[model samples]
Target: MPVVTTPPFTISSHETPTGLLRVSLSGEFDMSVGDALSRALVDAARRPGVTRVIVDLEHTRLIDSHAVAGLVAGYEAAAAVGRGFTVVNGGGLVQQVLDVTGLSEVLCEQP
Candidate 1:
């Protein structure tokens, strides 16, 4: 018999003195955690005194359509409230997904 275990996933957040809410994602990100990601982004954007929300994907190993959808939803949520939203530090597969989907231009900083 064989057993399979999924990689660990986590989300952590902090706020800077300038009202920037930085949310960091660790491990894999996919449909399993899509709802959580959306909720976190929305909540962060709507928080009192938060002027912007940035999701850090530097440590994420994987991402799927659901994750992208969540990001879009978060962006929309932030925009609806006049708050800025963006994503940063995504690389490899995660970066490719965002680029191929044309979301990098929308959610990430241009270089």
Candidate 2:
């Protein structure tokens, strides 16, 4: 059998307001990238003064069910810590996924 490798997706985080952390996500979000995404989200949730987290998926090209699960898990974890978690600026394919899955309401978005 030949060894297989998965492509990498980009995930970056930055502080916004006094208690807000913005996580910018892009590229394909699939099984291969799930672990990395989860780890990054967990780290961001644990940061001090981060009472809110906004996951920006505007530039994301693809997302699978596993990726949605990861986002939900991250949201739950943040809520457990009394923090807010939101998904913002998603349009086109990204928006379609959230809408069809009924996650648009569950995941907050910016106007």
Candidate 3:
């Protein structure tokens, strides 16, 4: 038998005084964590006095379509409730995907 190890996948968050939930995501933003991402966003958006969701991707190095989809889902969820959602620190491969998919400005604010 062999032990399998996965890449780092973590999510850290905080709430701002102005009704914003700021989330930081690092490691591989792939399918494995996609659902978690969506759920987290939805939870944050649905929080009392929460009018915005911001995700920081300063340490994210890899991503896939599933991740993109999750992010879009989060954005949609936020927008439906009059809440704002944006991604920042999008650099490297992550930035490329966001840009190529035409979601750079719509869903993200590059740093």
Predicted structure with the largest TM-score when compared to the true one: 1
Model 1, runs deviating above 4 Å = 1-7
The residue-by-residue lDDT of candidate 1 on 1-111, one tens digit each, is: 012124577788888989998888888878888887777777787889989999999888988988898899889989999999999999999999999999999999888
Query: Per-residue alpha-carbon lDDT of model 2 for 36-74, expressed as tens digits?
Result: 777677667767889998999987888888788878878
Angstrom error at residue 28, model 3: 0.5
Candidate 2: list runs displaced more than 4 Å.
1-8
Quality of model 2 by C-alpha lDDT: 0.80
Which order, best to worst by TM-score?
A: 1, 3, 2
> What lDDT would each prediction earn against the true structure?
0.85, 0.80, 0.80
Q: Give the Cα-based TM-score of candidate 3 against the true structure.
A: 0.87
Query: Could you estimate the TM-score for every candidate?
Result: 0.91, 0.86, 0.87
